[model samples]
Target: MAGAETTRDPYAGKSPAAPLWTADFRFFFTARTTSLLGDAMLPVAITAAVLHAGYGASGVGYALAALVAPFAALIIFGGVLSDRFGARLLMVVSDAARLVFQLVLALLFLLGTPALWQILALLALVGAGSAVFQPGVASVTPRVARDVQKANATLRVSESVTLVLGPSLAGLLLAVSSPAAVVALDALTYGVSGVCLLLLRAVPMGPGPERDGAPSFRADLVEGWREFTARTWLWSVIVVFMLWQLAGAGPATTLGNSTLVTDYGSSTFGLVMSAFGAGSVLGGLVAIRLRPRYPLRAGALSMTVWALMPLGVALGLAAPLVAVCYGISGVGGAFWIVMFHTSVQTHVPQEVLGRVHAYDAAGSLVMKPVGQAAAGPLAGVAGTVPLLFVSSAMAVVTCVLLLALPAVRGLTRAER
Candidate 1:
């Protein structure tokens, strides 16, 4: 009788178990994490390969740029495809494509027949494939989530776990043999992820063309844009994110890795990266217990942690100190990622989820190549340390901007 007196749960409309434990969620989650590990490993391995091949910082810059170049040109198309065809097929196909590309790279590297142009070409292909995989994976989460917050937390865990293992494993592979062998390991991971994805058997839920009359591509794109732009939280955060990417991610991905290669050996780079990954894992764990009253505020504040890395490096912090800086930053990044994705997953319409996610992807990543392309030549003129300083400062500014927006500062998770 007392049980009957209690009011029903507001979130009873959705499931109550954690999202990660669901069958579909577990399958896709594992597959994506495996693929992400492959992705993480490739950069470290490729960066090492280039340095070993006697390429300078400029060469490393171009290689990193190549990985992001296609995003500027083709990511919108990939997003549209995910919206049209659904995410599952796109993921399977992308993973299969990655497996093939990495396998070829591995063979070429192992045979000692590597060429800079060949590596760049392969990286471009993988980048193009990522254009499909990233949005596809993100859009699928709502279908399997118990709720938006749970979905976001689950995705964070997946990301953290992969980051934890990928770099360290890449370091091990690079140390034991060559970057080529590491590429081979990456290729195998792709294959495994693809197979696991094939075993996943859930039908996706989203809007598509009407049976009576199909909308034209242009109209569909317009609808997607409307959905994406209509949400202040969605576009505002991403606009800030785009600026942050241009100011920080490009430099960090390219120069940061290079700095480790030049200042520290491959083993040390691996350890620093492993520390970063470990920190992300810890952040994800913390996120599980944290139902922040202000999700967006928490997310914004967490991002400020990134500034520490460049400051540490600029202060000539070395070895373990550098590692610690990255670790702290990684934890912050993980928290922000969880909050941001949860915001999108929960707030956006399920029907237009793919299209909106596509728009988000395009918005968040559009400037990344610009940053990547500039890092090489800029570092040449300004010096790496100065460039790192400028980028870190910009990130801090972006984080501060988050405090001004009431929408973000006072956001909260839906209650059960």
Candidate 2:
């Protein structure tokens, strides 16, 4: 699966460009890109809608939490369903449901500031669709694309581009039109994604558990858990990332705004974020052409670069220096993601890939909210610079420890 596709692996020995020309890959990529754009814009639209309705920061928090809660809770089940029904089918169904929910949410805005509860409910439904769709997206690559790394690079590029453009575009639309109009545009993008998903030809990555005496849901779940736990290299990295999110990323995200505004005479937050996007674009492009022998080793090393961002801020570096750190970190982040995802797809058995991925995704996210929520209180007690320093140290320590595992450091592309 890694060196070259074998006969048993569905599509075999296809060149990197092979996926680009294939109808299936093209359709799937288009579906994902459009959906990503909608998601990128969704936060801005939701914020504008809530604020225009005379709500405060607390309301925005509720809306964001409503969207995040369901996805975090249900994503593991999403993996189960992906393995059961197949990736293509699950993606299509997820898209369709999300489309309906987004459309309804958009319409509600047209009714003169719809109730906060109504908006939150619709956003929750959309989040559930996302929970289901994510597993399918990860598992579907080997089925349609010839080169998994290249495919992942393409997706990363799309995500980075949308991150840079979506908010700016949303702001422009708000200036020229209503908040409901911006939301309607978000719904339209979902429609485009749904159509693309419907047009895709179904391809099963592995056999379903529907044969005689097949496993029940509980049994399947247990099997998936076993597969996840059995991999030392996998779980070890998951643990490291959990700590990285809890200590490094969480504080960086929550405290960054205050740092820029207070430390610098003005807010350069937007400028630094733009630098991250730019660096991510470069990283995705680099990923498309670079293939390493030891992906985990390289990916883990790349992640350590992220420690610089927190370190730079804690030291009260100039805006330009902090921006440079963010840019480099973004590049490292992209490399880590593509390498990690490609490694997972190539190493894990196709039958249980969805379930394993579910565990991986869920575990990585479980600590993030805790970290974000605790950051404020922790900063109040420990002081901002000290907390940021701790964040920076945690990242470097965790990543270094993760690489100490022989299984991780020695993982090669050709291994099963």
Candidate 3:
């Protein structure tokens, strides 16, 4: 009944003053934020575990890749399942699965030595769960919130807060105890998130549209593809981001970490990261209040700031200067994400939203591993500073190219 009521009048009983005041939204937001806190701990915990196992740097890479590769491979399938079963159901299942996996991981770390293979296997399972969980959240958000823009902005704000605080919390835990302790806490968060999902009743599970007979997975996949390709603006942005992810992600992760940590030390690198996180939070707050007439165009334009990060590295700027650049870049990054998600939710049909989002995510992330793998070798050959400059220039070019597309420039926010 609540689901039907929401379908009929999405804005009913919604308070503009406090979007999260609604019981359903409050529950959903709390679950998501709590899950994010645990997620923030994962990278640190996994890396520490691998290194502790005496596997060294390559082991760390393999372990991280094991987690990411499965998500990248299975995200589209997860989207299809989400669309078929309903976002809430898929999310609940995902949360439960992750809870089990994390608990096992925690147990292994606490009770006995976790072989590197065992760690990789369990991490991959968590990644697969995330592949399902992400699209579910994306599809469900618009259904739960009356003010889509504010809801999205609020979601970004949550992520920004987690980004700022999660690592610090993880570090503090690491300092006092073992990575296993940190992981056990992550498992506890997953349990809490699962409980929150179990308590959520505002959304219901169901299949998408069916034709003359029962729904065929292949047919559904075809329909999703058609929906995705039908929009020039959507596909174009996806393409740009694929390249953007490739060029920007590798250099920032590999070169940025290596260079900054080498020259300025780990503390300075942490300060820069904190500045970036602060800027991201500020950007989300700004987006909450500022309504751009043409959200896509504004978002595209704002993304140019990303180039500043690589430029700072390329120029061999002082730590403070580099931190300033990262802060500006972080603002742009947050603005882009909120605007882009809002735009997609506004334009895409609800039935196929999960699949489309999955496709978009897959395309955007598929190249990340490639970038990560290549960054080291490329940096060795081309030099980190010069490669960073190229990456920076490429980011600018990608944004400009996207802005030049008529579809991208002309698209406006959907009318409520």
For each candidate in turn, give its C-alpha RMSD to the true structure in angstroms.
5.9, 2.9, 3.0
Higher-ranked by TM-score: 1 or 3: 3
Which run of 10 residues does model 3 get worst, by summed lDDT?
1-10
Quantify how close model 1 is to the true structure by its C-alpha RMSD in Å.
5.9
Off by over 4 Å in 2: 1-10, 13-21, 202-214, 265-267
Candidate 1 per-residue lDDT, tens place, 164-280, comes to: 677668888788888777777887887887777777655332223321143677766787788888877778888888888887888877778888878888788878888887788
- Model 2, span 209-287: residue lDDT tens: 4322547888778888888888888898898889888988899877765787777644488788888898898889888
Q: What is the TM-score of each candidate against the true structure?
A: 0.82, 0.93, 0.94
Report lDDT (Cα) of residue 220, candidate 3.
70
Q: Sort all candidates by lDDT, best to worst.
A: 2, 3, 1
Which residue pairs clash in candidate 2? Answer: none
Q: Please identify model 1 stretches exceeding 4 Å from their true place.
A: 1-12, 15-19, 44-64, 104-122, 174-182, 205-213, 249-269, 372-389
